[model samples]
Target: MPIYIAIFCVLPLLAGLIPEYLVCRFTRRKWWKVLPPLAVAAITALVTAGRLSVWESDVSPVTQLLFVPGVPAAFALLGTLLGWRLWKRLWGPRVVKDRRGG
Candidate 1:
């Protein structure tokens, strides 16, 4: 019971994280950050809709299925923003060293 719930929650996150991280690593960049994650969530929701009932998605008022996948996008957005923030903080400026010393 709990295991299924865990899988349901984690599946979207993993699906979002892995690809976004890979893109980040290679490009060292983000595409409006949240957009990519949102895309991931949308696709995941669409693909898994068959496995999940409308009730599972829309009922319970808390475990809404439609929005579940977007949870991953929030994390992904946070990661992307944080990554860019850190990168800018660490490397956004140029360091100058005097070429000529007396």
Candidate 2:
């Protein structure tokens, strides 16, 4: 049985998270959250374009030039969330009181 599910999920999640984590660590800023998804989206777009641009492919000329193969923001956001959740779980989440009564 192929472990394609795990492989695909883990790789993109890490790729999306690492840069975001590092930037947040160094800058200690909340705005750094934007970086992860945007970076991942850019990477996805570039890779898609690169693959489509190869010879003998039927990719549209506009797609090759504009690199608009697919939108990664949605997937990127999902990956970012998953990565953060995994990281937090590994490190142990901090104890915080909930304002809402449970």
Each candidate structure's TM-score, on Cα atoms with residue i matched to residue i, is 0.41, 0.49
Candidate 1 lDDT, tens digit per residue, 8-62?
5555445555555555555644564455566755665674565466554545634
Clashing pairs in 1: 57-65
Give all candidates' CA lDDT scores. Answer: 0.55, 0.59
Pairing residues by index, what is the TM-score of model 1? 0.41
User: Model 2: how far is 11 from its true place, Å?
Assistant: 1.5
Question: What are the runs in model 2 whose C-alpha is more than 4 Å off?
Answer: 54-76, 83-102
Clashes of 1: 1
**Mind giving the per-residue lDDT tens digits that candidate 2 earns over 69-88?**
34333445676876566655
Worst 10 residues of 1 by lDDT: 61-70
For candidate 2, the lDDT comes to 0.59
